[model samples]
Target chain A: MDVTNRIERALTEALSQADLAGCPPRLAAAMRSAVFPRGARVRPRLCHSVAAACGDDNPATEAAGAALELMHCASLVHDDLPCFDGADIRRGRPSVHKAFGEPLAVLTGDALIVLAFQTIARVNCAPDRLLKLTQVIGSAVGVPLGIVAGQAWECESEINLAHYHRSKTGALFVAATAAGAASAGADPEPWRMVGEKIGEAYQVADDLRDAAADEDEIGKPVGQDVAHDRPSAVREMGIDGAVYHLKSLVRGAVEAMPPCSNGNELRSLIMSEATRLVPAKLAQSAA
Target chain B: MDVTNRIERALTEALSQADLAGCPPRLAAAMRSAVFPRGARVRPRLCHSVAAACGDDNPATEAAGAALELMHCASLVHDDLPCFDGADIRRGRPSVHKAFGEPLAVLTGDALIVLAFQTIARVNCAPDRLLKLTQVIGSAVGVPLGIVAGQAWECESEINLAHYHRSKTGALFVAATAAGAASAGADPEPWRMVGEKIGEAYQVADDLRDAAADEDEIGKPVGQDVAHDRPSAVREMGIDGAVYHLKSLVRGAVEAMPPCSNGNELRSLIMSEATRLVPAKLAQSAA
Candidate 1:
């Protein structure tokens, strides 16, 4: 099956696990809302693509991808709460907190995080591969370099742009590539650079969109960096510079891929995704 | 080492994993505050004690116990949030939200939850044993019957006392016993009842305290169950009936032990803990 189908099916199965007998309906629904009407599914796709490139299509790889996606969704749910971004709309619909109230939203995020790990644990795989996948995936969502640390950076008086971006966006991508490789019984260390570069490229594109794109284009509020006074590529570098930097990161990502048996397909996928990152108009203007 | 020291050291190691170099200082501090100056440390003790009873003192068992404690702590931190219990103190000091603000508290809880799973994942145990331990521990914190569901019950329009108590308190205790057994390379299913009875007994004692003990005795605000109009044994059964229930549950816990080699030691530990669950005056009054 295709990567998207694999990810969606895996995710559905995982959520069904959470939607077990006696689960509070609202909490389950809140978790669903945070995940469905998917937002790009970039992380999972990256995970699956890398695993495929590593010449393995193991069920554990799909599970790890789903786990990464769930972690991303969980982070979004928590990040949109009143304490953080306070975003009302996500994926062009009401955010989890907005739809399910704050308390259920909190529990939803917590449940999803647990579900992420549980999804991996439930997969029947070689124990060694499972252990490596769990460690890589777990580290991506935790401190001191995981998304949790990434969010905590916002609370500090002074923030390091590199640290914030890496933790918030890059860590999971790193997990994606590394875990995918690990799931395929390959060395994961060489895959880390690909993830890091792609993650950096994605963040730069996001900043460019936040700075230059229309609100309707992104499906969320624009100029949040200025409103929240968050440091971003656009704020540090000019729009042109940020766009140029994004291109460099994308190229770097393609160059960083470890030599695998099926590298061409993964490379094409990354290139296509890179093209999609910038809005058409922005891409044209930058060109 | 003794159980207490084992639990404390394991917990310290787990927390240090979160206290890494680039972690935001306040977030790190908040995570520490939520855990340190420990409460009863009941869950970990139960876990370690059960592991001992199962004829294993593996480091993985200690790590499982620590993971359980961290999950308990994470639940408490989130439970005390403004959207939930809205408490101002825990363990006789300012709660996580009160001490470090709501946002950090949220992140701290999130970080701790991740740390719990990461703790189990990082343990150098047999792969099959580690996988089983992760599944047991993960189930105790997620959905259907995890603490998150327990908290979600409070958000629902109607609450079932059995479901609430089981998910909220019993789940982790079940995790403790079951994970301990799993870590010890034993079947965890038989140990579930021991955990269930103990957890129920502890909750009953807590209800009695809420209804009958002073604030000073419990180290936090008293009368919260009544204040929040939550379901409780004291409310469902009168104070005397609740006390009677507590004693019965404690007896049941001892009887539920799975006939391990060190059952006598574990039974004695349970009896001693049961005696301590209720205040001296309350125990005497009930007698």
Candidate 2:
């Protein structure tokens, strides 16, 4: 299967595993439905690219991929807590906390955190490499320097968009590539730049969609950033500038890869994704 | 150094590497104080036993030991959340949520989860073995079978005490032994029974105390199980029956260990601990 297809399957499977408890049906269904066909399995796709780059053909690769997705979902679940974002809606539907009571949502988020590590740890890989992957995954998901820190930014009055995106989005990207490399027994350090470059650009792309992309075009509604007064690429750098930043990042990612056979295709996919995310003028329909 | 002291120092140093931002001084102090100068470090001591049993003497054993304690602390943090136990106090002080608001408590719990894997991942063991350790820790902490499931028993209408303790308490014990063995390059399966037996017995002893132990002596307060209407050995098996069960399980733990230098001491410890848990003097104190 293609990387996207495999990632989708893996993510659905991971969510299923995380949801095996005898949860309230409405909550269980909502959590599953929230996950089944997620808008973007970006983290997993990046994971696949890095794994393929580092010659990873093992179950650890899939595990790392699915694990990152689970972590992202967990962050979202917690971020919607009453104290964090107090968000009642997500993906044009009720957020997990809104659909399920806050208590179940709390448990679900807790479960997701456990599930992420479980997924990574269960991957059958060389023990050392698996350790590296787990370490990388853990570092990307936690405080001051990770998604946890990213969420903390919301509670603070002065937010740095750069710092915010790096922790919230870039950290996972860095981890996906690093984890992929670790899975294949790569040094992991070499892939770091590739992850950072792409990760930053992805954040910029996310910023772009905050205003440029319509709600249907992106899974979540546009303009929440503006509503929240959170800084963004579109706000700081403008839409065209964000696109330029993305192109520059794609270049960096392409350049960061080694002379491995899979490198070129990986570069192409990232570039294509960047292009796909770029704004396009729609053709006028026939009158 | 004594086993407990050595393990606590190792854990303190290992936890220092956690560099999450927004760590309030009080939270840091609380985290430090909550663990530091710990009472027994029984879990770490358990890690040491299995590691020694498998002939591991590296500093990585320290990491494995620390990881177990960290995971335990993280579970406590989550368990004390308003949605879970609603516990405002723990270890004779305000719990994490009480000290640092719910958002930070949640983030702190998340940080500990990541930190546990990071600890094991950075250990001196071979990468593959370390990976297994990370996985073991995550599995111990994960849901449906981990501590999260154990906590979920509270939400459940009729949790079998055995099942609850097995998942909540036994799971960690099992992970500790498994991690210790993994650090020593052991297959870890051989030691699974040891953890199960010890974990189950510990819970019975705990329940036995809950039935009659004094609030001052237990240090947390008894009658919590009854207050919460939570299932327990005292509730089902009664105090006398719980003691009998504990003795049998202690026998099983002694029998389960390999014929090694530590076996006699471990057996003695379990026996003494069982005795200490239910002695006439303690009963008098409880009354």
Best by TM-score: 1
Worst 10 residues of 2 chain A by lDDT: A278-287
Pairs that collide in candidate 1 are none
* Candidate 2 local lDDT, A1-287, one digit each (tens): 77777777776666665466543334345446556556578778877887786676567888888888888887888888786778887767788878766766766677787777777766655666666777788778764467776665554446666667788788888888888788777788888788888888788777777777777776566787889777788788776666777778888888887666477557777877786665443111100
Which residue window of length 10 is worst by lDDT in model 1 chain B?
B278-287
lDDT of 1 by residue, A230-268 (tens): 888999988888888888888899999878989887888
lDDT (tens digit, per residue) of candidate 2 on B88-175 = 8776777778877788777777777777777776766567667677667776776556776666555554665555677788989888
Candidate 2: which stretches are off by over 4 Å? A12-34, A53-58, A154-162, A212-216, A237-252, A255-260, A278-287, B20-34, B37-39, B53-57, B156-162, B275-281, B284-287
Off by over 4 Å in 1: none
Classify candidate 1 by CAPRI docking class. high
User: For residues B1-287, what per-residue lDDT tens digits would candidate 1 score against the true structure?
Assistant: 77888888998999897667888888888988888988888888888888889999799988898899899999999999999989998989999999888988888899999999899889888988888988998888998889999899888887766778999989998888898889889999999999999988888888888888888888999899889888889899898788888888888998888779887777888888887878667878655
Candidate with top lDDT is: 1
